[model samples]
Target chain A: MTRDRIGALFFLAVSIAYGLMSLDIRVPPFASEGFTARSLPLALSAAGTLIAFLMLVLPQKDGPGVEPAGRFLAGLGGFDWPRIAGLALNMLAYGFLLTRVGFLVSTILFLIVGYRLLGERRWHVLLLASVPVVVVFWAILTQLLDIFLGSALGRWGQLLAAQFSGGA
Target chain B: MLDGILTGLSTALTPTNLAMVFIGCFAGTFIGMLPGLGPISAIALMIPITYGFDPATGMILMAGVYYGAIFGGSTSSILINAPGVAGTVATSFDGYPMARKGLAGKALAIAAYASFSGGTIAAIFLLIAAPALASVALSFQSPDYFALMVLGLTAVSAFAGRGNFLKAMMMTVVGLMLAMIGSDPVVGMPRLNFGRVDLLDGISFLLLAMATFALSEALMTVLKREKISDAARAATQGRMGSLKLSGAEVKEMAPVVARSSVLGFFIGVLPGAGATIASFLAYGMERNFARGAKKEEFGKGSIRGLAAPETANNAAASGSFVPLLTLGIPGSGTTAVMLGALISYGVDPGPTLFTERPEVFWSVILSMYFGNVILLILNLPLIPYIARLLTLPSNLLVPLVLFFSLIGVYLVSFNNFDIYMMVIVAVVAVMLRLFDYPMAPMILGFILGDLMERNLRRSITLNDGSISFLWERPITLTILVITAVIVALPLVGFFRQRRRLAQAGEGG
Candidate 1:
């Protein structure tokens, strides 16, 4: 299938799934609103399904910048998928580490890994960019803005300190 | 009205607000100059920072960013022939040529002056039109609001350009579906969460905006392996000849600027039509209006060519604010982001904004005047310096952008789920974008979905569960009729064109 046709099929499946799921929305007994929560979702699913169905059945029309006969696999193949995947992994890792480590440590590590993944080789450039940014951002959040940034580890530390001081 | 203006003037002139205008513009320019990062991304990045600010100050800052981003986009277009924003694509046609002719400084100057003129003229029009529209909108009931939202969404799809109607419509429907994911607006009952505590609150607009525009855009840049060419770097560092415009050049651009400013403002007021369209239209209009050698000079370094789009786009930027401020309907993606920010600030934008918090309404308008002036005075000289940002390697830039987008959302809720959810959404957005689907309509649909549903539910309730309210009131009927016409006209044109082609093929 062409790229758009493939997209259409995906959307068609999504619309059907969403439509089925809309049936599960439970309305409370005392909620007397005329339009229930499922009303718009159900309507949107029907509209989505119809549109996707039309897109699938209709003759494939190419928009500007899109070639009519471009294959889905061909379009996806040219992209630098490995690099993108690396970045995604990095982001996911950052998210996992953010709470495990404190904000300062997590953010610095995130920036350094990000820079390295993107092809930065110089140690000075990486450290200068990541460390100062983390420090400044940390100061701004904690000191300047007075907004507290906490981590799981920090909470654990606080708990330990409270217990050591003989407080519950 | 005079009192409102005075209130706006007082708020806008405050030292803190003045500094905000400068800071917003500078930051916006820096960010917008980056390839793949437009005004939407720039403003989305600023949302977390503006969380603690007063509504007027936040808006003033955002408005400045909006104008600055457009200006910054024009700079990249002129210098590198790579339009940083879609709206500046037309600008690169003549602008890059002029820059190649060793008039980069002059081109930048003309763009600044034209943007200033366009923005100022539109601000004046805004000053007049906004109050009138707000008063008219005061009488808007649920049905009228529902119809207006329909008109807005329909117009967005209708104007999604040739071959994109179905795609835009589908994306819009997807947005509506996404909007229904969290808790139901009316009853606060969970619908599509599938029993997750995080899903009960639904999706955060900030997270969605950050994921789709900021993170996805950054990832796309990396995925495409886009980098600033050495030629672009040299152009930035090279000596730009002359920033002064001759008298004849000024006279030539005056009429074009005036005409494009008007065209741009009106087009901007229309739902779905925005700076990109306004710029293209203005460029086309000026080409048609020119005579003899001047007409042929277009796309070959004609002053009028560069000035027309530069002016129209800025005017259109201001023009877009009309729908957002007066009707609470965002006319374009950039304004949709702003509308989300306004809602987050606990200041519902619409008719009541003018009466309830005139400072926010007027100060934003007044700030435009200052924003335009700042672009002319501040950015005109700083172009050479700001243009250097173009040379910043994407390797470093993209990662920083990714970090900011992830951290921006994480800072808001301090929730790890948002980060993971954002990455997932960004990946999906990237996939959808790869298939030639426009993301703007999706964002627009998502932003308007809740409001549209609420109005729709209210209309149905008030009319005793009948949807007759769609045509009952005059305003509602008129808006719906207009929407119908907008959708029909494009499809009619498409079918007619296809038929003509078929007949020709048969005859042949």
Candidate 2:
């Protein structure tokens, strides 16, 4: 169907779920005098449900600011989804690796991969762009700002040293 | 008031704060010159950097960035016919034409002068108007605050332009729903965290801002497969002539700048009506008021045409700060982001701010003057070198932007969960953007959501379960009544248009 229809259905589902969840919020006896914790969320859920329902049922207006109806699937097909998905995956991987490998290594890998995915394939360019930038950024954070960044390798080394000393 | 002004002058004139303004302006300009980025993104990017700064310095820096972004948007409008921000779209109508005539340098100079004058004039207005308004706002109660918040939210959707009212409202509700995620604010008990401890503290405003504005915007550039570097290279080819304006050209633009600045400032004072609307209105007004030949020259590189929007947009940017300072209410998305930043600094911006932190309140206002002078004197001569940054390839630039945005959020809490959550939010934001939904209303809703609920809860508690307080207080009732009118007027127009269309069809 159309994009607006898809949006309506999505919001409708969200509001219903939200309304159900708000019911699970526990209100203490002392705080339940007039307005409880669940009060605003419940109101918002009802409002969201009503608005979404109206959007689904009402005729979509044709004028400025409103795009003409197009098949939702077709509209989605035109986007460079592969590239976007790659970027999203890169971000996810960075997060996973950050604390595991440390900020410097994780960030450098993130930038190099991001550049490669976006069509920068030059080896020298990738190395030059990623390494120096990451080092400078890392130095700024650790040295200048005095923020601590944990290194997984350093932690492993410490653990090994602790085990040997205990055995001795 | 004199003492407050002197305090502001002393604080704003400090070495560190001046450096903040300079850095903020330079960074803002560079980012704003990039297509698809606006002041909202510019300000959002700076929030991480400002986290360590004192409140006054932080605000001064943000204010400078706000002006610089608008000014930088004008630069792209003139050189590349690409209005990086919506506020500068009208500037391209005449600005690009002037560039085409080999007068890029002259056009840049004119824009700088016009922006300077507009910003300076509006800063004066803010200096006079802010404290007076803050004093009056001191008497506001919880019920009145509740009403005012409702008014601000409704006004945003009302001005969401034709045919998008329901969509904007839906976005607002969604934002409100998002705000209720972490815990029950009043009870301090977890509500919607789904048993995840990471979400117990709730979604950070910085994460939300960066995800929606910065990350999503960069991803959108890649999604569209735009050859941004090619476009930038093409725009930077021509000679920038001389940065000089003849006396006749100055005379023609003088009245337009003055008129548009006043109009822009007033419009900017209204919630949801910011720089974009101000610039367009100013352009239209100048076109209508111009005499014969000058009127024909409108949109054909008329000096008045270029000056009107440039002046008005900067003035409007300054004017938007009024509500943020006086009422603790943000009139637009940029200010909404600023409000979140201010709250993170442990400074609640409201009427009491004037009495409690007069230095912060007045310094922010005073710094606008300094920002304007710096933009004109230092930045004007350096435009060509700055414009060269536009030639940076999208492949390199996009990755860096994404890195910065992701890293900025990650730096705050140092949580891996935040990064994953940000990616998810950015994806959702991209989807919503593709559906033609505006992100500003959602941000506005999110920023105002907690405060609105607090005021509402207090009002309800005070009234002993009676909801009549919504109409019982004169100020609160008046505010709500205005909200009703704002919501109704748009619906009324929609219906009338439908009826007219039906009548014509029947006649045919």
Candidate 3:
């Protein structure tokens, strides 16, 4: 019921779920059993879970007697609706525009919206600042040479080629 | 040993290799100097650009960024009392004190020099130790690996814990559990997909890191509503003039440097034991060792105090790599990012890498030494200049970090879906940070989740549901014993303390 304990619980749940999920990881037949890709993390996570469970059982009982700190954390809980909504919208925006608008454009727009949401607010500022950034990033990573930023150029190649042909 | 040094120097002195080290170190320091910035973020941000380099060159850049970031974390701490990341918190203890005493010049010198001592000494240690460790471990079986991980987890709890040792354990355990959500290692069945393709990969460790460390920190700052930039500026008020160490200061620092280097390197060798502990432990050890008139300098601005932790942590930073390069096991969050970087380059870090790929091994080793020198030189003059960057407004710094992180994260997949994921995770990360939940274990969890599950499946399949399987292996038994000791001892101690506290409270 400790807030910090609850915090540990939240992460602990994630560990259990993660460990449980490892049962299904696909490994190439060629991969070795002892030190294969999955083996290292699988062992590591189990240890992580063990460590977390111990945290719950042990008590330092520091400072003044503990009191419920927050409604949600203290178990007087309700959904974190605002955060859930914000996250949902953010995902929706990215999913919708990923291929439709292209990597650079969609990425810039995403960064701007996220910045604005965090209170960046000024469109002129966001545009002036964010655009050059994406361009410089584009120039440094893509134009100069291929650097992996997920695949904006690859996806847009057909559209870009079609335009080039049209212009020629 | 001498031949190794000469060979290392010969390869390191080449124009491209030298330049790469310089670039890596310079980049590392740049990110390190910027408060709230770290190597992982630097790597994630620059991953897009490095993708084009020769794998070794790319690794050099990443290696530079890694060490540089560790070295950089102290700048903000000394320059403004704000720790750039979790690793530098110990550095700030005495660093800020020395700065306030007008001995900032001395403090900067100690940090630069101590960083050098730690980095170079540990690099040497790595050169000597890595080969030995790898050669010995070349024949490990799956059961053995499971045992090793248990050993590493125990070591990690020892290092990552402070006020809440049990909680740290809890955090570690939870981190491990979450890492297990993806496809089963044995048969490839997805356990937590909830029917989403993305879920098949489970949650990405990198995504989790950005969400928890970078994004969460960003959100909490907003919630606090105080302008950190202004406060930071006011706090870091100083000139970065020529940083030099006085003869007396140098003399005092020499022994501290030697001691911390030894201490830092050993601790860093343990997987999951990060620089944070190396520094804190060094600080405690220095205080204990200071028995003379010099003892008074422990907390109130001792250059020795500052030198020890910086050297120790940097050494520890180097030590963390031993496991990574030798065994392919990342010892800390930053190293985890490095592991991801290696993967992106399609390079696996394990015993065979040494024999099969000497260039990758040696070149990276050679680059690290030069990187340390470059960091020292860069940080020496640049500290004051970069200290000014400490004044960035909260609104600006916050936005910039988030922007770059998102860009960095998005570039990871160009899947705006990832960006969206970043934002959502960031918000959750923010909540977690606000509540004082340590983010390191979560990052540790996410990073290790996939592998934990895989090994479990493989082991169970190999053992065929025999409950005695884990206990049967000698290595496994030993590790389990250690884990049992580590886990049990701490829980008992914590409970005793709680009872004592409760009784004392009633008496009072």
Clashes of each: 0, 0, 42
lDDT of 3: 0.69
Ranking by lDDT: 1, 2, 3
Give per-residue CA lDDT, model 2, range B1-508, as digits (tens).
9999999999999999999889878888888888888899999989888898899999999998998898899999999998889999999999999998988899999999999999999999999989998999999999999999898888889888777888999999888888888888777889788999988877888999999999999999999887666666766776888898999988888998999999989888899889999999999999999889989998889889999999999999889899999999999999999999999999989999999999999999999999999999988999988998999888998989988998888888988999999999999999889887899999999989989988998888799888899889999999999999998998799789889989999999
* Candidate-wise lDDT, in order: 0.90, 0.89, 0.69
User: What 10-residue stretch in candidate 2 chain B is worst by lDDT?
Assistant: B226-235
Clash pairs (backbone) in predicted model 1: none
DockQ of 3: 0.27
- Which candidate model has the greater TM-score, 2 or 3? 2
TM-score of chain B of each: 0.99, 0.99, 0.90
What is the TM-score of chain A, computed separately for every candidate? 0.83, 0.84, 0.55
Measured against the true structure, the TM-scores of the candidates, in listed sequence, are: 0.97, 0.97, 0.83
Q: Give the i-RMS of model 2 in Å.
A: 1.4
Segments of candidate 2 deviating more than 4 angstroms: A31-33, A63-72, A152-168
